[model samples]
Target: MSTIPTATRRRVLEALGVGTAALAGCASAPGAKEQATEAETTPQEPAMNAAQQTDVDRIAADPTAIPDPIDRSEPKTVSVEMTTKEQVAEIEPGVTYTYMTFGDQIPGPMIRVRRGDTVELTITNEEGNSMPHNIDLHAVRGPGGGAEASMVTPGQTKTFRFKATYPGAFIYHCAVPNLDMHISSGMFGMILVEPKEGLPEVDHEFYFGQHELYTTGDTGEKGHHDFDMEAMAAEEPTYVLMNGEKYAITPDRHGSPSMSVGDTARVYFVTGGPNLDSSFHPIGSVWDEVWQQGSIAGPPNKYVQTTPVKPGSCAIATLHAEVPGPIKLVDHALSRVARKGTMAIINREGAANPDVFEPEA
Candidate 1:
């Protein structure tokens, strides 16, 4: 296995205009060196057959598993609990990788709260885990976004309190020294802080998290792959995934989110990129209402085709299932879907409207 030198990685990040703080953080962290050394020493194993597979279950979070909307009109105290989990899982049919996650799934769990609500957040690092972990919620207005107050080592748990003063869909992620690697490994999620007046109702709601994974093996190579920090610094990834697995949210795999024709659905998407930006687009439909950058304070942009969601940011968009068929969700970069494995589906089940989309035989 080959690994880029620390100096080379630094140069790559610097050339890409990555902030000095990130560069400094990576430089100061010992994990980078340790990982590089491990990558060099580790032997690449041959592809494993289906019969040899042990871990077949995916780690991707369910898009439909979202918290209920806040019903209370007044502020209240909310408690959020998350546990750090590290496990080996399949990225695709035969490809496997070790993922560090929050609550056993990629992007973790969706946290919902209303503006002015006081949240008592607690995080527990699973026993026997190898590393320390902490969370920095974009919704919080405090030191390290509450990360400083919630750092936990293996077998330890910590709690912190913060008030959601503003309303927005925010990305919450691990904020350790090697945060980029951690975020890419699936330590990120979304928190929807509803505005006082609240958002308009939709027929359905879905949550998704987008992040890149840098592995020692090439895309789709079978067997276990180790994290490649060098590729991350160079802004290249082996796989760009939605949720956690490759094409996990498609009808053929875990099954996509289902909806009826003419129904409206809102998608809460958080990009934990640690590098790339997502040109979020829904094929066969346009975003009927787009809360750009996850800001729900003002009116949404209507009829938007696509929106840019930067790393460590969130976006909320509503889609109207106008015509019946599969609606492919992609980053619009194309290659990520074609090569790196990043695509999702929305299955709209109902009669097709020929007026909106006609096919002549």
Candidate 2:
């Protein structure tokens, strides 16, 4: 007769939610009223009764369906033309350091591809005494990236192929035993497997690699660039460079290496770490976009301006190349770049030697 107490009603409803079938026909019994009173005060809804009134209700259900984005059988191929190209870098202003490189550039060239692409690379080893140099692409699905089976012996050539899965900005380096030696000797590169979910394309992409060579050190003079075997034995790389040339990134302030102002340049950067990551940055330029975690998904993070590069990481961005002077690409490990590394100049419009492009600093 009196309204059921809210507390009791709530308790009843809570228990009813979990199969109260035992009450069955007895639901209408004397105590049944008390049971209903308890449920009435429940905060929870009693949908059980509504279903009970519908015995012939066709069961309704919702289905969740998601489609697979890739087909395993038809992977795309990405091809690389591995030819040795010679170029120089700047370790300091007014000075040049020469080194060997893949396709004339250290960190090699930028291998870009769309999602689900199969890459076929043609690697050519020439002129260098380094034997059996090969590329093992991290993006590859096959064993050893097929590098173990495919390598271009000195003055030799070879071809290999692989399917690119799990898009990201990945590294392509030598998998040789003295792996560090191969890489440090200028055998490293970057590969971009664009994700199925695409990303924004940038204006210019410049590619470069950060690596250390265990060459004999130089004891000629503290300030002189000479090879000192003792220092080298200490695992101290005598020289450091970007793109095969020493000091290629350092600007020539006193009438030396230079870059132009209008050249839209992007350095496709990578660090074939000798167990160290590179925090590469342009002293004057901002990174317009970045490719990280091996560049797997999303539009490239834009207007990044500054980004930290772990070993094996790379990116594509625009920089004011030919800026009427020199631009420095330092490790941000600043000291290393100062102590080692190389530089180069981008001369523009018969500027003779644009030297360092110091912007009113």
Candidate 3:
């Protein structure tokens, strides 16, 4: 029942433009929606042996595996306990926020593992007072790949444990160096790992994405009521949400959003990238199967329709709202749709009286 009280669904595409196609209004979904067409052809899914995608792309570029990349390993304490102040909780439903998150919502959970199994995490950095945080996983195995075992110093509390043999879909950012202002004021998450016989369990799953913040206002609207740090060290993130506000993910809160008509909803796209670059469409429901790159083992690539998740990717389509009212949930990038990205409003069936879409303009 984890509403993720801590947030973890990056995409905030357009960074400051509305999202989900302004509330699509379903109907299509019987078929037809493929488009990646292979992007090129030769690389039509079969080109990643470059020494294991370059030794896991240098273990996803230093998430701290540092065996001897020049010697480094001294962060094994794992105490963490400063996380509190929790409030904002709707991806879509009235949309109330307080921002300056860590446990309230903004890109925060989902760190499952298995590939090589060896995760031992414990992060607690209470609000900003005890700021200095750490976590660079990227599916570890060696050399600055675990970010020298998660660095922390904001009230102190650090720990490190590694081994995850890089299965796929890795990411656990927060190298902290103004690292996107602590991953847009929420730090980050997602490290799948699973590969010893896992993944493929779904009756209904949820994990949306998109968040790039830097609000203290400059007309970026309200980033949970601004909180400048010199505009976050000049990061310039002015309200750009999707799973943290403005119709967050709406589906069960009210304004119509529940999913059930036929029941399929998997939607787990991530792309908080270093910036933004998502275009994930679901309008009128399409994607029959699309584990695209979130591939832990790989094989779901059949139906499609507007799929592009750059900026630290992840995907897992599967719709079937079955002719609902407004099943939207965009970032299809379509001109940012409305400013600060978002488009929730799903009501597959009924619950709180379900009248279906139309929470007023």
Best by TM-score: 1
> Candidate 3, residue 23: CA error in Å?
43
What are the per-residue Cα lDDT tens digits for candidate 2 across 1-361?
5654333354457667733465466787889888888878776632121111221111100001111223343446646687753223332332223334566555666677766777778877775544667778877788788777566677887887777767777788877666665566566777766566554443333445677654322311122132223333455565555654454433322222333545555455677765566666666555555655445465566666566766555655556544444455666767676676533333333243336554455
Residue-wise C-alpha lDDT for candidate 1, range 36-120, written one tens digit per residue: 6787799744433332243438799999999998888999999999999888788887677778998989889999999999999
Question: What order do you get sorting by TM-score, best first?
Answer: 1, 2, 3
Residue-level lDDT of model 3, residues 1-361, one tens digit each, is 4321111112233344535574233224333233223343433322111111110100011111111111212222222222422233322222223333444444555555456555666655554444566666556665556556556565555656666656766656667666675665455555565566655555565666666555433333312343445544554454555555544455333233365666776666566645776677777666787877677475887778778776666776777665545667677765454765455555566333245334453
Note the Cα lDDT for every prediction shown. 0.88, 0.54, 0.51
Q: Roughly what TM-score does model 1 have, to 2 decimal places?
A: 0.86
| Candidate number with the higher TM-score (2 or 3) | 2
What's model 3's lDDT at 25? 30
Task: For model 1, give the 10-residue run with minimal summed lDDT.
Answer: 47-56
TM-score of each: 0.86, 0.58, 0.31
CA shift of 334, model 2, Å: 1.5
Instruction: In candidate 1, list every pair of residues with a backbone clash.
Output: none
* Per-residue lDDT of 120 in model 2: 78
TM-score of 2: 0.58
